[model samples]
Target chain A: MSYRIEELLITTLAPMLEGLEHVAVGAASPIPGAAALLARHRGGGRPRVSMLASRRHASFTDGARELFDCAAQGRIDAFFLGGGQIDGSANINLVGIDGYPASRVRFPGSFGSAFMYFVVPRVILFSLEHSRRVMVPRVDFVSAPGTSPSNVYRPGGPYALVTSRCVFRFDRDRGRFALASVHPGQTLEDIREQTGFDFDVPARIEQTPAPGAQDLVLIRGPVGKDISETYPDFARRVLELDAATA
Target chain B: MTNLETLVEAIHDGASVALAPDYSGCAMAAVRALVRRGARDLRLIAVPQAGFQADMLIGAGCVGSVEAAAITLGEYGFAPRFTDAVKNGRITLRDSTCPAIHAGLQAAEKGVPFMPLRGILGSDLLTHRDDWKVIENPFSPDDAIVALPAIRPDVALFHAASADRHGNVWIGVRRELMLMAHAAHRTLVTVETVVDDDLLADEARAAGTIPALYVSAIAEVREGAWPIGLAGRYPADAAHLAEYARLARTAAGFERYLDEHVRGRASAA
Candidate 1:
């Protein structure tokens, strides 16, 4: 049986968030938000989830100011980031493509990405589209760089890069990504052909784990309902929860 | 003095102006008025991030520089005008992160030279910024962090749910507006209503209010945060924003939009 790509993504990110105290999901992120809620549901709410746009999920009263302060104080453990383009070195470009001031393609300006990428210990780089255009040889501009010098006093960085096709673990020391697992429907060659950047491949690649039966039940049931409050369309489309039914 | 245009005239060309972020109380009425007044070359600072207000201003050619973490329309997608401007090298882009902006504004509020921030250790933002410095913490030489310069602005502008006759504005949990007001030389506000009742008499309400001393001008404009909406008062006009996104794709369409909505409406004002 084939599981949905979103299901696989949720399961993949859940483990990364294990034993974390808190995980924050920014606006416009549905998969990561669902995964954070799923992790909380599975772990008996061990890792508190903070959804930037959701009233129920957010605890702070001061909005982005509080969110920024919490990240600065090292209260948030995990965060999700996406870019217009991402490179082998884990550099992301949230700004436009081509150059700083001039570009052909433009994305939304960099929000709390650079700040959170530095402060959050386990920053997961995710993107739904894993094509060569997105996963680039080098990002046009670095919105938040993956690594810094040893003397930079950095405690946080890209822990892993998860895409629809595969999962790659970021090696800070080597400043390169290592192929971890190929998604169920994809082959290593498929990843290689689509990826713009080079990466290290192990002798044996594992299949990305699928969501368990029980996990699916939680995902389809209460978790689906919980996320609907924040991501209505995602819940309706991905989980097949209709407005009347949900 | 109570007129929107008169209030907008207080802000001059090439002035550094700070505005609240998307989720905060956005003064769309005042923003429209500013566009009408042909305010140009403003260094518009988003408390952290902004959406349509920034996009519309950028499109109207009323801004010279934008300093923010991001300019987006949230689920609706990239801010088209802002995107186009950045792509064409038309505006000064001060790419920043959330905490850096907040800390810089806070530094200005406290009359400090600079404020040390926790992160930016590995970010390209640090490398790009000339104003930011990385210093070994004298408290702990082992620890190094980024220090941001003060971001004192010429004016701070926003909309509020209500303001009292005394000019104290009730902002509730949107405390960043207070920081913006404190850090700027002049704070101009547009409120949904100006109540005669004194808000300071109630300690609970007073705690959330920006006292009149910091407020330079207050204009009573009903439904002030139109199209974007005021928190707890009204919701954003999603259909209108969607229409805006659709039409704002082309320069001609954007101009048409400006004429129909912004320029046209301002003429009526």
Candidate 2:
């Protein structure tokens, strides 16, 4: 029994690591960044891990405001994003990109996701917290398309959806995604029950791996106190979801 | 102990400082006052390296440009061309800028790890820095890390709405002033009116912000946000901005304006 965040990072994201040529990570995306960096370190140059603000932090070499243009045009290899609002179609809206009333939801505004989604062949999404409010049937807006390849997305759309509960895969043709597998100890019915919309849950799901002690140390070290500071709401979510980012 | 007179005397005699948010608050006025008192040599730092106050400093020959393309802002935000401002004029843009970088000295003085960032990597800025180094994460052998060096200034300057005889100050609404006082090696707090000490203390009490220990000096002066844009506090005087825009189009033009306004004026007196 390992911490949920540790498991999600080490087992789920770690094993998924293939030899991506170059990957772009966006805002609130320290998990994938850490995961990729960890994998390449543990797995040996698996992929060139990068971030949307790589230049800002000092580790990134290719600093482009528009990830889709460069990624679609073969500037980068993969991208990672999160959806505050996702629908059955896999389309996501971080928050309403449309004019906000200033009363309700306040997301930090979309940062070039449209172009990135339409271009990158490999897209991985991780939800810091998963809930019915997050995994909805339809997004409030479309920052990036989730399903494509039918000329709708000339290149591709989201390849995988990593949630707190389960991992999802999309049909390359139909564009509707199905449950790739539920995490270890979780049932397809469990995932279905928690989701906001009806979805095709496969009978088979895999158990996610927990991060080892060494992995946990690495995961928590670079983050410093900034993790809890940045995600103050994590205390509430951690108790509710019974998950940990290690 | 350096009182207001000694500190203002030092600033008047040419001290380098960074002016946060509103044209270093009243450092310009303090500098002018110093000039009237026969003190000289004042340099200051402003963000958006190409803006009007920045131009005026260059015009007055007080500051040339930011020492490095990047200075920390406690909580203000980032300027996209920060790296480009020093790097061969090639600016790569980013997306998240939080307007806190203008409060760099504040965080240093306040003793914080990292302030929030607004815009940095969401633009073409990233493309320009392929030559920049990317290294393995220091703690995580498997992860990567980017090295951001520390930023420290020689002197800090800012203005507040009011100050007491003891040099305790209060700036309404704007927190950028507090940030400047904290970050500089030598600091100056200039104000329009010398108010009651309790009133300034009450203002800080309301905000629950930094104490006066962070500020090194204070001088009473008016029109502190002059020749600089201060939204809602004072008018920016767009005509002045446009005029500065013309003079600051190049380094040579900026130098001439500084010579005429700053050096020439000093020579005349």
Candidate 3:
């Protein structure tokens, strides 16, 4: 009857990956990794998952350049990006906080996020923390802008933003997020209170679907084992796969 | 001469130096040696990104600027010194995306003034960079793209699993080192061992070899990438890195770490 937030997030994201040929998961993403694996399992391995950190998932032998090159050549269909701060416009900031150049707080500088965001067709933006501190009115810096100008030759942009509180599908033409559904335990008021940015709230919000028994079985068994090498701590802690397998 | 001192001496103050990405084949031995030698105010370039070497250099106040994609300790968590220095505005942070860094070096590798890159048009990374230009494709004329100037560092430094007497280094799958070597003005390498025979003579090993012509100097330093592993040669010293992460939280703690592990010791290993 009950499911973990990770499982819920995975299930929420799985549909976005419906017919994607190749999905690439970036650094520090255990949930997205699980979701990608789950999507693959559900698709009978249709959408190939390439995790930058995983030996099992990554097919590239050349190095980081190859990953970038692959994305450039339009090989990667879906990708995941996270940020220190993500805003209403779908702009994600992975750079430091407070200001430009000099900031009071600093995160690891933007890795391949900017380049990947522009190329990957289905860019699912997810952050585990959804407080106002994170979901600001505007990020101090934009590591990857959610949308691009019409003449910019852009092929990919933000599809949706999945947070701990709710799911907001990004309307590219409007350049704003529309609240689609709230997680089961969370309320619209909770999302409103926690989120710093403004969004278009639908007349009725749907409940984010909970993972079924079969989803949990796949998550706990094969998917958990697949991501273990890349995310040993996450697999052990979240899924409790270590004890289950042991 | 292919000695440790010579390799360190080649990297002068304010020199734009490029290094390989973390966990591949980090030249930790050279990094420690540079610290021990009091190399200062160097503009460090992490080819795509960096970790221990960049953090340690920043903590030592040896770095003047950092141009990279990201600088984190991966599974180990935040890179403290780099984070602290950036917050304090101690170092000039030229934040970049991963492919851009690679593309920039690639331009240098081809001896080009600049290279065209797809993506980054809408990203703030483009807005902040004066050096990066947005232009219509000359041939296509209809397509808009971003062009990055060449990032030709003054020196390229990395460690490898092995090198022969002839000075060819075997890097296997870590081709970024080769890119760094080709892009920079000079290449410095430290290897785990010096083989008796030439690496290029063996067809299998030769494909992975960066020829001696590209290598300015080579030093055989055992466990060169100590805290960071040398690919297949050894595993990372996790306890030592954990100790580093623990101690490098503050300036004083970092200095204490430097004294014990860096300056006080005869060598890092």
Of the candidates shown, which would achieve the greatest lDDT relative to the real structure?
A: 3
If you assessed candidate 3 against the hidden native complex, which CAPRI class would it receive? medium
Off by over 4 Å in 2: A53-69, A97-103, A212-246, B1-269
CA lDDT for candidate 2: 0.50
Q: Candidate 3 DockQ score?
A: 0.76
List the candidate numbers ranked by TM-score, top first: 3, 1, 2
Complex DockQ per candidate:
0.65, 0.02, 0.76
Query: What i-RMS does each candidate reach, in Å?
Result: 1.8, 15.7, 1.2
Name the 10 consecutive residues with the lowest summed lDDT in model 3 chain B: B260-269
Score candidate 1 by TM-score against the native: 0.95
Better of 2 and 3 by lDDT: 3
Q: Count the backbone clashes (under 3 Å) in each candidate.
A: 1, 44, 0
Superposition error at B43 for model 2 (Å): 32
Candidate 1 lDDT, tens digit per residue, B92-133?
Answer: 888888888999999999999899987666666777788899
Per-residue CA lDDT of model 3 for A54-173, tens digit only, reads: 777878877679988998889999998998999999888999888878788888988888888888888999989999999999998889898888877668889999998899999999
A best-first ranking of the candidates according to their DockQ comes to: 3, 1, 2
RMSD in Å for all candidates: 1.9, 18.3, 1.8
DockQ of 1: 0.65
After TM-score superposition, what is the CA distance of residue B212 in candidate 1 from its true location, in Å? 1.8
TM-score of chain B of each: 0.97, 0.60, 0.97
